[model samples]
Target: MAKPIVSMINVEKWYGANHVIKNCNLNIMEGEFLTLLGPSGCGKTTTLRMISGFELPTSGVIRVEGESVEKKEPYERDVNTVFQNYALFPNMNVFDNVAYGLKVKKVPKDEIAERVNKMLKLVQLDGFGKRRINQMSGGQKQRVAIARALINRPKVLLLDEPLGALDLKLRKQMQIELKRLQRKLGITFVYVTHDQEEALTMSDRIAVINEGVIDQIDVPQKIYNHPATRFVAGFIGESNILDAVVVGRNDTGIQVGTEVGNALGVSDDETIETGDAVSIAVRPEDTLFSQERQPGFSIRGVVKDHVFVGNLVKMMVTLNDGTEFKINRFSEDEMIEPGQVIYLYWEKEKGKVLKTRNLVNTDSHRDIKGGDEDEEEGYAAEA
Candidate 1:
């Protein structure tokens, strides 16, 4: 097996009494694109700073290229960082900006010119070398920042929301360009961003962080399809979280009862048992709607509102008990009108039962056989 380019072992960071990063352990393989994804103030940027030697950890060790770098300064480490604000020299042109690193190292003038030219061309800024930084656009300046970092040929590159300053269209274009450059150069990239779509587009694996803790680490598809925690399910994407109770279990599936008087047979979670309170999560796109009842568990609801959002229609359906559920239908047909009664159903395998109580209130959960009394009382209590 190939060795990892960067590794963090039980790393922790604190700003005085407030803990910023808690026990972060991760291994980034060589030549892989890894993204640290989370909301603002979730320690993603702090973790990146620690790895780049800008902020030393209060405890634990960080290794780059198989060597511990706890005592090294930012410039002494075998890594380079690209910040969100492009720190280019306004007075210097693109060539001089990219060549500044080599000049600081006191490299020969001839070698500096050749390497700088190659780096500029590698980032597709071949003819823009003489253009002043102040005259260039936002996207052009970002490319100059990347080229400056790459000229060092470091073992690992750290990016702290480098694309955050660009507009949406330019950001999308840079995402593709960055991925291509990483592949061609075969460099290890440690990226930090709060945008889920950007992380999904560029990362080989993502570490989802929440409240100074690592929630789960996996590929984009696996993280979306099989979230280990309820927080992860709700954070990564939109999910319909329902409070339910486990009534029975077997090898095939487990029976669950929700506050809407729907007894659902969902995949069994090994940690749950009979009489255990649980929360069930289902994506809005996984449900099927009809005018009449279908086989298995079904809920009768009236379409309270329908919103047309370009490619998809978002419908808000309210049950008789006043419980509202949001469903997204991807169709170009005429929108479903409000006040229309509809039946909503989904396949048993499409929903996941979660044992983590942090997702929903346990006291409001209802039993399957409790009928109308359970629905009315539980719904009222939640309200």
Candidate 2:
């Protein structure tokens, strides 16, 4: 079994009187890419800082290689952080910046030059070592930052939204590059980001945080398909949530009466009983819509509108009580139009039932936002 390279046991953080991270626990395994994903002010960044020794926890233990890190300073820990701004010195060239760590340790000049060149090559900045920081592009500077951080040969690398400043196209390109580099190096990475797609694209596991609490932690597919909480379902992706109450149950699943007056059959949970309120989440792509009534589908709604968005079409259907349900389809072969009534259906198992009390009291059709500012820790001198 792979040992956990980093562990946070019952971690808690407080900024003065404000409680930030609340009883957060996690284990990042060796050589795996784990992403701490959440919206602004959700404590994702703070959690990463705690691991990197940038911020100290108010309570609980943080361990690296099975040893506690609570009493250690940032530079003493066997970890390095790549910040969003790259944090390179304009006075130094790429080679100097990459060689700074080795020079600080008083390594021989010949060895420093050899390691710097290899590190630069690893990040694809081999021949550009002589170029000053100000002369490099955003993507190149990001590569330099990563190379510099890794040159120290730390056991773990902490990236705090390192691609955030790049343009959309460049950001997408760097995502692939960063993932490739991690796989090649076999180093444990504890990444922090608010972008859901970025997390899904690069993570071996994702810990979804919200309001100082972890809502769920799992791989991308599991987090998307079987979200453990209402906040997770709404936050991770676009979900059509039906606020419902359990009406009946059989051997297969439980039947729930939604606020829109439709009965939805969802996979059963032993703890859920009739009269219990639950939220049903169906992804837009999983929702099926047809002009004619389909078997096992009793829900009726009027077509609101649909917009062609690249490879797929996005549709909006309004229920009788004015709840907007969304659907996504590959093509408009059925040809839906506004004011036309349609029947909605989905596979029973696809309708994920979230049986939890931590519900976000919001409309099903809107984008979910995690409230507050992500703790912006002051940047100190790097080790």
Candidate 3:
């Protein structure tokens, strides 16, 4: 196995009484794009800062290239940071800004020019050397920032939401550019961002952090398909979370009962017990809708709303038990309308049952298989 280029062991941080990062541990491979993904104040940024030497851990160690870097200053560490803001010197032109690191290192004048020009060309800004920082567009300024960071040829590059300042289209364009650059340079990139799509689109692996703790770490596909926790399932994408009770278990799958009046067969994770309460998560796109009744694990509901997106249709369905479920359909044949009776079903493997700390009550009338109007009314009253 290739040894990890960076490792965090039992890392913790604090802001006075608040414990920001709690015993976090991660290993980042060399020449990989690893994104720290989470919502704001989730310690993703704090963890990134610790790795960059901008913030030291209150406890534990940060190792870079197999060496402890606790005592190293930010400048002394073999890494460079590209901030959300371009942070370029207003008076300095593109060439001077990119050559600043080499100049500070006192490289020969000829070497500085050679490196600066090479980096500008790498970033596709070869002839823009004389352009002032203030004269550049947002994308141009970002490119200059990237060139300045790359000119150092550090072992790792830390990007703190580097594309956050650009507009949506420009951000998308830069995402492709950044991934290409990373591939060409073969340097470890530790990127931080809250955009799930950005992380999914660019990262080799993503560490999903929440409330200062690492929730899960895996490749984008694994993280999306097999989330380790409920928080991860809810945070990474849109999912329909339903309260379910484990009814039975078998070698291949477990049986779950939900209030939507369906007994679903779900893949087992061995964490579920016969009587344990769990939350069932199904991705919206995984659901199949039809006007006719379906045979498999199906629930009948009225389409409460229909939204036409470019390529997909979004729907909100209210079941007979008054439970609302969201579904997405991709077919464009006929538009589904509100008040239309529809059946929603998915394959057995599409639903995931997550063990919850609290066992939800599964004995309500809504949890039963009957479609009694009075029972539905009573269930609504209790809700």
The residue pairs found clashing in candidate 2 are: 41-373, 41-374
Q: Model 2: per-residue lDDT, tens digit, 73-125? A: 99999999999988898999999999998999999999999999999989888
Per-residue C-alpha lDDT of model 1 across residues 1-383, encoded as one tens digit per residue: 65788888778899999998877677788888999999999999999999898899999889888899977899989999999998889989999999999999999999999999999999999988899999999999999999999999998999999999999999999999999999999999999999999998999888888777777777899778776556677887777777777777778677677767564546434657887666777787876678988765557889898777888988888977787777888873544678898887777777777654322100111111112356445544563
Best by TM-score: 2
Error of 3 at 52 (Å): 0.7
lDDT of 3 by residue, 158-256 (tens): 999999999999999999999999999999999999999999999998888878767677789988998766677888888877766777787767667
Candidate 1 deviant stretches above 4 angstroms: 263-269, 292-298, 319-323, 332-336, 357-383
Per-candidate local distance difference test: 0.81, 0.83, 0.81
Query: How much is 297 displaced in model 3, in angstroms?
Result: 3.2
Off by over 4 Å in 2: 267-269, 292-296, 356-383
Question: How do the candidates rank by TM-score, highest first?
Answer: 2, 3, 1
lDDT top scorer:
2
Give the root-mean-square deviation of each candidate in angstroms: 7.0, 8.3, 8.0
